[model samples]
Target: MPTTIRYSISDLATYFESTTYDRIMVLCDENTRTHCLPLLTKWIPHFQIIEIASGETHKNWETCMQIWEALVANHFTRNSLLINVGGGVITDMGGFAASVYKRGIKCIQIPTSLLAMVDASIGAKTGIDFQDIKNTLGTFYEAELTIIDPIFLQTLDKRQIISGFAEMLKHGLIADKAYFHQLLDYSFENTIDWPLLIQQSLHIKSSIVAQDPTEKGLRKTLNFGHTIGHAIESYYLEKENALLHGEAILYGMIAALFLSSKKFNYTSAFISALENFTEKHLSTAKIKIDITQVMKYIQQDKKNKGDQFLFVLLDAENQILYDIPCSQNEIIEALNYLHD
Candidate 1:
């Protein structure tokens, strides 16, 4: 399952002009509708536009129903093409909707946000959060193509850019340490060269995904920071001042690093380097976990089996140790360590 990640819009324009579908429809959130869709409209003028509310909060069945209803009303057939033109939430929910609609439909991803462009849009893992759980219902439906235009990043605020940068950092940590060093060169103040950064992140992820598409083994490393990150993201969903996915992920990575040192005996210098780097880049929030409540979410995590919690831990060599069944007590201990 090698995902074709288009780097240049000129190349994408060439492809879009030559390609044709029965019915072309595009799904975008308010933000992307304002900022990014215009670029697509230039090349694809006749595509039907379906606008949805933005944010991770709207990623649910109700919104998905709206998408399905729209597709139904439009008389979309299997040959119809669905283009997702927003960040992670839009692509995730839209891909899920497009996949199940009429059993399946051809879909393409035009990832505007850095998060979507890098990780979410590449994997073809379509999902929507259910009952506050992250990505509860989903399918592995690959997009016919994925177009990544770094031009969209021009409108992004520092926080939005930083949000995506977390995943890139994770990619480096999980696979290539040298890539991690490359990431340290930029920040919210010092801008990044998006084309190169996006390509680097894509290569790391695609190479890993190429080995294991259905997450049977190696793909689990991608879930490194997510196990705890999703819990934090879910817990804060109802709050007014919620952290973005990457912000939450930074915390999860910190906790995971702590756990890695305790569980896998990861090198002390590497753990310290990661902690210092993360703390420097991400703002810390005083999220006082109920510890008990969060464990419930972890227990219900998709990676877990009956009464067992699965973690992807980093070992001394900086390689991932996936499918490590960790004890609840150990997790609690890690949580306590984080709290301290």
Candidate 2:
């Protein structure tokens, strides 16, 4: 049976106290090594540390090969534990490496970013993006445990925080109506109640993954704003520098909202609320979108089926997410709304 784990900052020591392993390897990026590892090392004394170059560009086969070589050279056997200690990129690649290494090994996730804690950490999906395509190469491997510590948010830049929050907002829009309304009441300036938000988002993802771990059915709901969001992210990432994951999703959410209103006849009031929430919280970074480039990227999206592009749009109350298909022209119109 699979074990369900709950992670909290205060419970870090207690969580690791009972764990038994011959050797432990901690994977971290530059930023995390400088800011997070010092604090983490005090608790986990009997562990070897490895640092990889930071950023999305480094997530590739070459990197994976390097990790594999290190494990082999160091004689890291199956009895060893791989502890992924960073954001999405670290967790995704680390989890993938551990899963493939030695056929399989126990891995744990200690996510630092809000995005990782709520979304990436919970899901078994792990992979590296190929070329410009997002998450093109990957696997479904759940970690033995996931440890979430909001205290690490102190080291994150404002942009990183906002990026993670977009996914959290996506959780609310897709499944929980009450959580959606509650988000409307909180501002980014205020400290988020981490425990409550983490539990709610975990519950949302856990329910979906429990029903469909392979993503054949209801797990599609979690892709609410990801369709167009990922395209925009890829397009801008290729054309420009400095666009964060959450920022790209912010624009993706805007395009999705427009699609929801147009196709679903979702009420104008609901639309206004979503737009207001976006403008107030999301930054205005103008991205030059060549309609052709965006269209090309969308064609390669993993969610695309046949000729139509599928999107997860919400109803008026924000309770149910309807999977709707849009033609090429409709997608262009939705992109225009981002410019407006």
Candidate 3:
């Protein structure tokens, strides 16, 4: 069965009334613990808290060990409940931990950041980074429930919010052209409609995941920008000035657009519009291309089959094409486009 998703905080409280657990633990980062937990505690006041340091840098085995130790120390049984409350890192790692502990435990996801609400928490994909590779260790574990409350979005800064917005843009690009255009009109500076946009984005993702839960076919389209994007992300993972996942994806999408133009004649008008949109909404920050290092990461990507390079590209009609092979020169040219 698909995971149950609740839109309001009140729904979460109401849910607890009908559910029972031997022990309950809320896993969050320091940031979420400070900003988002108070709201949750008001409704579900009896759970123990396990707080970890925030950021992608900490989403690894060490952190999982911390959570597992906490669970063990707290005597968390298989019947216990682990509620994950934070952005992508928390939901991903929390779900993985819960799924692995004592075989499996019931877990709930309460995504606090915009990225998590729209993409990470909605999908049943759970993981932790291993040896600096993104989502290297993971399980296809579904949460009991995923609670999405837009109120937590208030706690994020513009950068973090924009980071999450990148995934929303990808959702539109892959599935709904109407939504793609609708999101093009969105501006961070102006008043926004969070609930409607969130709902739409979540719907696109959920519908796609429902069709291809294990990514055998249609779901690969959802990775349109992620192949190159993840490579760029991994390349910067060790740097002092690391790139956020969404920021790297924006670059990846631009590169993918270039590839699409080569493969399927994507119009100049659309390309120009995308450029204008990025100019308006994104930062002027540029990442110098290190093609050698990036190619290494790309080769390591999970989507690759044997030694061939495969990507999810867009067609002239803005439709997605998965497992499209591109030559080394083409891939380098796409990355080079970002440099210019």
TM-score top scorer:
3
lDDT of 3 by residue, 1-340 (tens): 6789988888887888899999999999999999999988888748899999999999999999999999999999988999999999999999999989999899999999999999999779999999889999999999999888899988898878888888988998888878988988876788899999999999999999999999999999888889899999998988988988888888888788889999889766766666666666665534686888998899889989987889998888877899899988889888888774
The whole-model C-alpha lDDT of candidate 2 against the native structure comes to 0.80
Q: Write the per-residue lDDT of candidate 2 for residues 161-266, one digit (tens) a residue.
A: 7778778777887777678778778876787797788788788888888888888868988887788888888887665464678778878877887887887776
**What pairs collide in candidate 2?**
163-246
Error at 237, model 1, angstroms: 1.2
Backbone collision tally, model 3: 0
lDDT of 2 at 298: 87
Which runs in model 2 stand beyond 4 Å of their true positions?
1-3, 9-17, 316-319
Ranking by lDDT: 3, 1, 2
- Worst lDDT run of 10 residues, candidate 1, spans 278-287
List where candidate 3 sits over 4 angstroms from the true fold. Answer: none
Q: What TM-score does model 1 achieve against the real structure?
A: 0.95
The lDDT leader among the candidates is 3
Q: Give the TM-score (vs. native) of candidate 3.
A: 0.97
> Of models 1 and 3, which has the larger TM-score?
3
Q: TM-score for every candidate vs. truth?
A: 0.95, 0.93, 0.97
**Which segments of candidate 1 are over 4 A away from where they belong?**
none
